[model samples]
Target: MEEKKMGLMKCLFVLFAGGVIFLLLLAIYPFWLLFAKVTNLIGVKGIRNTSGKLQTPVVFYEHSVTKRIVAFVAVIHIAEPAYYAAIQELIDSLKGYKILFEATGKLSPQEEQALTQKEKDISSQFDFIFDLMKKINELMSLQYQKDGLTYSASWINTDMRLYDLIRAFAQQDISLIKKGRDIDDPFTEEFGQTVARWFINKLFSRFIPVGVVLSVVAFFSRDKRVAKRLILDARNEIAFQGINEYLKDSDIVTIWGAAHLSGIEKCLKKSGFREVRREWFTAYTVRDYSLFDAIKKGMRATKEAASAATALKKD
Candidate 1:
């Protein structure tokens, strides 16, 4: 009887451990898949750490038949000012290339107001996302893409229109939105509202790192499949159409989000463009500063400011 009892206890312990492991794996599976997909699409050189600085790739592909060059300038929306400056300098150097950029073309005030109520709601949600991005920029001390990069009139915008995007989402019967609304029905409205308020408060906390906030947002995003399909896959097809039109005569330089690079690369390859060269640019560095180090840096800045003021007075 004692031996049987011991065996049963051991079995239970093993089962409990296995269950925990399974849960952890399940929780991380989506992120793991995303990482794997990115790696496979862009290779190990796509993103890397070089001496503590995170680097992103700028890849150049050459057409086999026409010999025209197509450069994919992968960019992070929020990054150091210097990184953007470096990218601008590179763009300036590519004098003859036709610039293609990603942007959801804007809607005029009249057009915006003309939108249906469902479309307006969808548009408002997008506005909320941009507002959230601005808050993140403030907390992270990073430059936004719009402020960092200058757009020339000659550059082509190869993305969907905002009005179309709003309409698309509005027309779709997205279960994620439906489910969230259902949670706010008379039965669970109060509890749902309380939970939402708590989440929003925590999400905007300064102490939370930008990366953690973004990761949490991505994890909890209602419908990843629908969002990715509309935002990424559809946009990629439009970009490819623009590239195809320009690649016949002009050398093309596409400045697009890093996530879109893989799709663009695949499209180029299918059209007989082979990657000729690749370069890595340092996007940002992770600095782990002690409290003393922070204080010393602050003191140095104060001294510099004083010196600048003294020079200005003298002049």
Candidate 2:
């Protein structure tokens, strides 16, 4: 009888586990779609899904009358790193243009190559996407600095405290990884790992306090996977929110991760925008570090808009 009872309990446990997984899938599926829509509105494009008909990019060309509305979406990656200008080029080709402009941040071939390596090398895990970003930034800065140009940080914004914490956290994480420590390694008393973590979190907490808190939570919490997923979801929210806010007044042209951009076209129409456009802008081929020069040249256009006060002031 005890054996039979034990078997029944095992069955119940399995069923409960299956039910929980089902509920999670049900919640994440719709949310994934909702996120796609918002990301599409600003300029994420080229989405395909196995489950449903994906959204397409919107392009509006209005003239003289305000009746015309257009939202442009462009999905970008290492292959198509130059899509950041796709929408702007379209708008400029026309005469007497007035429209709202918004864009997701650019991901260059150099950055993409770093991300791919980080992803492929399970031995070297990364925290946030920006963790990889800082490495590529350093690499790019080196080339430029050697060429007699000084570069600050790409993560810089209005808040100095928050910016420092983010930079420090990124610095610590990247350095640790380069030293060959797996992400899952337990902290040792001799290593003073907690001090490093604390320095990063406390210093940068002002810029991204949520990120710092979550990092600390991940450090202490056992459910690190769930914490990571929550952080990613938060990043998606930030991208979507930033894109939405930018679209409110300008003709938006955005380039963000292709995975994130998928299925966002539908959201633009629902938001009262009309006629969106999307296309393949560029393709990225995987190469080595020596190819950094070509990749940097491809991404040099970022400097033009990167210096725009009007765009920077929006965020």
**How far does residue 266 in candidate 2 sit from its true spot (Å)?**
5.5
Which tens-of-lDDT digit does each residue in 102-157 have in candidate 1? 88967889879889887777776777567655655654577987788888899998
Q: Write the per-residue lDDT of candidate 2 for residues 138-164, one digit (tens) a residue.
A: 332312111221112321111112222
- Which candidate has the highest lDDT of all? 1
Query: How far off is residue 254 in model 2, in Å?
Result: 3.0
Model 2 RMSD, rounded to 1 decimal: 20.0
Clashes of 1: 0
Model 1: lDDT equals: 0.72
Note the Cα lDDT for every prediction shown.
0.72, 0.38
TM-score of 1: 0.65
Clashes of 2: 25
